[model samples]
Target: MDDFDDDSFNDVLGSMEMPTSPKKPKVQPSTIQPVPAATSTANSSNNTSASITVAKPASNPHSVLVHSKQRGNPILKSIQNVPLEFRDDIVPDYVVGRTSCILFLSLKYHNLNPDYICQRLKALGKMYELRVLLVQVDTPEPHNALKSLTRISLLADLTMMLAWNAEEAGKIIETYKQFEKRPPDLIMERVESNPHQKLVAALTNIKPVNKTDAVTLLQTFGNLGNVITASEERLSQVMGLGPRKAKRLFKTLQEPFLNK
Candidate 1:
């Protein structure tokens, strides 16, 4: 019975089957393709078109650059390379259409060279839409600075007068090129004379009194009429003017009033 039982146990172990392990699924290679050269070029071209910007061309050949920032209303789009001769109130109709204007007077009253003036003008032109008009004045001849200034001021934005006589102007023109830098000694700029400037200029003509004294006198007295009516004692008390200058100034103002 022991032999039969041991044989039966061996048979039962042999008849039982072992469990099988599961197999993993295999990964496939990627099917996505590389981009074509033409597709890439097309995409780049689309991007370029989207980012690009266009600018408008100027109305005239003489017009200032399109990118320039305009300030005051300029009389002309751009300054002519050649200067215009100064006539009696000869403002052009074209000047009225511009954004801003500048009058360059190469006159007897101021001594700036044409090149220096042009350089400065161009700088203003580049920075703003400025048109420059240049004129040469004969100093020896009876040229009225005030009249010229008034006429030009009426037509343009600003006026610059070079305080040089015709002879000096000619000398500078002969020696210096229009594109060259200006010499420090040769540079003299005079703005359009207003009432105050005229007053100062007139007072500077007096003996022992200068520009500083004239300004001081004006500051002290307020106006020309006051300066003329001021007592010599009061005028003498000013910083620049002493007793002699005050007396002279008092006398000068009195003469004009007395004459009138």
Candidate 2:
């Protein structure tokens, strides 16, 4: 009976008309069988041609659906949003500010390299026209924190790497005391060490003179000799040195030096 049923099925299939183009192989949903572990091992050792294939059912005939999620493109979007003028130019804000920054690292936080720090400061100072001031800060092993801070405060404008505590904060507050304003005469000796001190002193001899006038005098006349020889009219041409001050400068420059 089974042979008769199979023969009739084959006769029906052979009598049907076949399509001109090749059709996809139809897979029976019930025919998917997982390979057994023992069988897989035996197949691998024997190098058999038979292999297990996994097929997912297709919902749409045209497109293959991906299981993974997609991510937004931030870099490309940012580039698109940037202004046209700024697209090619790149400059740091600190370079434009023209302010020198010094890092005052504590011995605890960073290894203190005095020689390296001094060398860098000196080199950068020359390159940047004395605009650099880096210094390392530390309390002496035997001394109190206040004394250390006071000492370092004179050398550095800002502090870094110090532990955050009440004592440290109080020491920082105390450091500012060293920079209190004092009379100009009291700081005269300090200013004397500066190269501009002589020019400043010479300009001070005239009435109502300031530091800017002294700088202008140096820049305009080049040196003290040229300033002394400069006529009142020529001195008046310098910025900030008006006719009255120029006359006073001329008179003071021409006056004979007297023994104290």
Best by TM-score: 1
Candidate 2: segments with Cα more than 4 A from true spot: 1-191
lDDT values of the candidates?
0.40, 0.37
- How many backbone clashes are present in model 2? 0
**In candidate 1, what residue range of length 10 has the lowest lDDT sum?**
36-45
Candidate 2 lDDT, 1-260, residue by residue in tens: 00123353344334423322222322223332232111001111121122222223333322221111101211112222111121101110001111222222233222222222222222222111112122223334413433443333334322333434324422332222222233557646554666678667767767766778888898888888898898889999999889988888788888889956
What candidate 1 gets wrong by more than 4 Å, as runs, is: 1-191, 256-260
Return the lDDT, model 1, position 214. 92
Q: Pick the candidate with the highest lDDT.
A: 1
Candidate 2, poorest ten consecutive residues by summed lDDT: 87-96
lDDT of 1: 0.40
